[model samples]
Target: MARLFGTDGVRGEANTAITAELALDLAVAAAHVLGEAGEFAGHRPVAVVGTDGRASGEFLSAAVVAGLASAGVDVLDAGVLPTPAVAFLTADLGADLGVVLSASHNPMPDNGIKFFARGGHKLPDDVEDAIEARMREPWTRPTGAGVGRVRRLEDGGERYVTHLLDVLPHRLDGLHVVVDAANGASSVVSPEAFRRAGARVEVIGASPDGLNINDGVGSTHLEPLRDAVLAHGADLGIAHDGDADRCLAVDHRGEVVDGDQILSVLALALRERGDLRGDTVVATVMSNLGMLRAMDEQGVTVRQTGVGDRYVLEDMLAGGYALGGEQSGHVILLDHATTGDGVLTGLMLAARVAQTGRPLAELAGVMTRLPQVLVNVRGVDKDAVETHERVQADLAAAVDELGSEGRVLLRKSGTEPIVRVMVEAVDQERAQAVADRLADSVRTHLSLTG
Candidate 1:
C-alpha cells in the first residue's frame, strides 16, 4: 500500500519520493495499464491532463504529459485547473482516462498524481493494485508516429465553466459572496464560475505564489473566509483546498458551516427539487451523529462507509445513490459528478440559497450538531488496539454509559501506528472526557510493552 500511492495518489516531497523521472515512469506505466485494459476505442485512447497551482506541478505536469504522449495516448493538456474539472473533462470529452497532478490538501513541498478511469471515475482498488504490481515489471514504449502526441487545449476552463452554469438551477444575482481559493487550483476558475452565476464575488487567497496554498486559508482552516464574509457584509463565503475538490462555507454572520450542515441542507433541497435519487445519502462513519438524527426526521436513510472519499464514492455507485460526502468537506453529488467536487458542491449549495431566498445559515440549520472530540494516541500497537479486550470493553462501557446521547469509536490509523479515539456527546466536555478515558484505556492495553 505504501509503494507508489497514498490515500489519494503517488505523493511525496518534490524531487524526493516524487520526481520528474518517477513521474515519467508512472505516466508511461499508467498508459500501458489503462490502454491495455481496452480503455481506448476505435481511435487511439486520449487522456486529459491537468494540475493544481503548486510550484512543483510545472515539472511534474511536463513529465507526466511527456510520458503519456510518448506512450501512444493523445494528450489534452488543460493546465492549472481543479481536479474535478479534469474529471468532468474526461467524461465530457469522451476521453479514455484523465491524469491529475495534485496532492490535494497536502503541503507546498508535497505533490502527487491521481487518475480517473473512463467516464471520469477514480480507478477501482483492483485496478490500483494492478498498476502498482505492473510498476515492477518491464514496460514497453512506442516509437516514432506510433507514439502518442500531446496538444494544448485552451477552452478547457471555458467548457467546464459552461457546463457548470448549465447545470445550475438559478442565477446568483443579489448575492454577495466571498470565496477563499486557498491559493490552490481554484484560484481562477472558482471566482469566475461564481461571478458568471451572477454573484457579486470578492476573492481571498486567490493569489497563489505557488508556495502559499492552504497556508492559513482554505477548508482546513476557515477563519480567513469567516472574516472576509463578515468584513465585507457578504451574503456568504466559500473555501476550497489545494485541489479544490471539497468546500466549507461561512455564513453571512461569519459563522462556519461544515460538511455535515451542507449535506443536510442540500439533501432536503434535492429532495424538494426531485433530484435526490432514491431518497438516500451516503456518508462516512466520521459524519456527525447529528446528521443521522436530521435524516431520521426527514425520512432519508443513510448508508455509512469508512472515512475515505473513495470508500464513500464506491458505496454511492454500488447503491446507485446520488449524494455522498465526508465530514471534512469532501462531497460527491453523483448526478453532477462522479467524484468529490468542490465547485459543484459550492454551486449547488449556493444555488439552494439563491433559489430559496433564505440565509444559508438558516438553511443549514436542519441539524443540530453534537459535540465530537477525537484524541489520537500515538506510540501504541494501533492494529491490535481494535482487537484488544480491554479497549473493546472500554468502548462498550462508554456506549452503555452514554446510550442514545453518545457513542465511542476506536479507529486505527491506516498509515501510522496510532489509534484515534472519538467520542460524541450532548456537550463538549463530556465528549472530551469520554475520548480521554478511551485513549487511556487503549494505551494501557495496547502500548506495545510486550
Candidate 2:
C-alpha cells in the first residue's frame, strides 16, 4: 500500500480518498502516537481543531473531534479558520496538539488533514510515519469518565487578528486596499483585519458558498484581483488561497506581484528596521535568481533550500534567521508566527506601502524577475532524469549555452509520474525554447514504455 501522507498531509478527494473513516483513524492514531511520546503524560491532552470553509470540512472536523475525544483528548473546535490560526491557537491556548482540515489551494472537492505538535511545529517525518504505523494497531477505547470533552473557541479569530495588529509596524490608515479572500478560510477575517488596521478595503472572492472555494478566484487566479484593483483604483490588492496560509499581491497598475517579489520587499523592510536576524533570508530553490541578486546588492545573504516552506523553515531555524518563504508566497516571519500567516503577511506588506508612501509596484521593483518557463512531462520515469546519459548530456549542453546568464533545473515530481523542466534566462523566448527542448529529451529518454 502507498503511504497515506504526502509532502503536506493526508490529502485527496474529500469523502472518497480522504473519507470520514480515514480522518477518524488518523486522529485516533495521532492521539496514541503523541500521547505515548509523553506529550500528554501529566495532564489531559487538549487538541485544537480548525478548518477552511469547505462543506466537506464540516464532516471531517466532526470525525476528528470524535476520534480525539474517544481517545481521551479534549477537542477545542475553532470552526472555519485558517490553518495558521489553528497553529497559533494551539500554542497560545497551551494545547497539546493541533489539527487543521484544509486542502489549501486545492479545489473544493479536495481536502486534507494536517497535525501540529506542541508549540505549533509541523510534525517531523518520523512522527508522521509513526502515526501511520499506529493506525493499524488495536484501539483502547476509553470509558465514560476517562473520555474527553469538547468545547468551542469563540474568540480564536479575534485573538489571531489582535496578534497581527500588535505585530504590525505601521497602520494602513491612508491606504486603499482590495482583498480577494478566495471564499476560503480568510474570507471573514482577512478583510476585517485589514479594515481594522485602517485601510479603506474593498473585497472580492469573499462570499463563499463552500463549493465555490478557489473557483476562478484567490492567488492562483490573478485576473479577477487585477481587474478589481484597477476598477476600484485601489493602491494594491491581496489574494489568499483556500486555507489563507499564503498571499499574492497586485500593484495599482494591476501587475501581479508574486512570492519572490513579496519576499524581496519584506526582506528589505525588515533589514531597514534592523530586525533581519543574521542578515539572512531563507528561500526555496525555485526562487528567481533575481531575488538572490537583489539580496546580494542589499548586503543580505540568501539561503536556498529544497522546494518547500518546511525546508526553508528548517534552514531558518538552524541559522536563527528571522524571515524565510517559498516562491509561492508561503512566507514565515519567525518573529510573529510559527507558520505562514496570510493575514499577517498582507498587513505587513500594506504597512510598508503606508510607511514609505511608495506604491507597491516601486517596492516590488526591488527585484526584477527573470523570464521563467516550466514544462511538465508526464508518462515518464522521473527518477531516471538524473542518471540518463542522453538527457544529462542535453541538459549540460543547454546549461553551457545559457552560461552564467541562465540556469536549468530538472526535478522529479514527488507525488506523480512526471518530471518538471524549468529554465530561466534574460529573455522569455530563450527560456521557453530551452525548457521545451529539455522536456522533449525527458520524454524520449525516460518514457516508461521505452
Winning model by TM-score = 2
In order of appearance, the predictions have TM-scores of 0.94, 0.97
lDDT values for all models: 0.88, 0.91
lDDT of 1 at 353: 95
Backbone clashes in model 2, listed as residue pairs: none
Alpha carbon lDDT at 102, candidate 1: 87
lDDT tens per residue, model 1, 1-450: 344564576777888978998888878888878777877656887999999989999999999898888888889999989999999999999998899988888788888889899899988877877777766357666788888888897999898889889999888999999999999999988999999999999999899988898888999889989988989999999999999999999999998899989999889988998988889999988889999999999999888998778899998998889899988899999888888889878988999999999999899888988999989898888768767887898899999989999867779854335788889999999999899988898888887874
Clashes of 2: 0
Give a tens-digit lDDT track for model 2, residues 325-439. 9878899999988888788899999999999999999999999999999898999987789999999999999999999998898888654457989899999999999999999
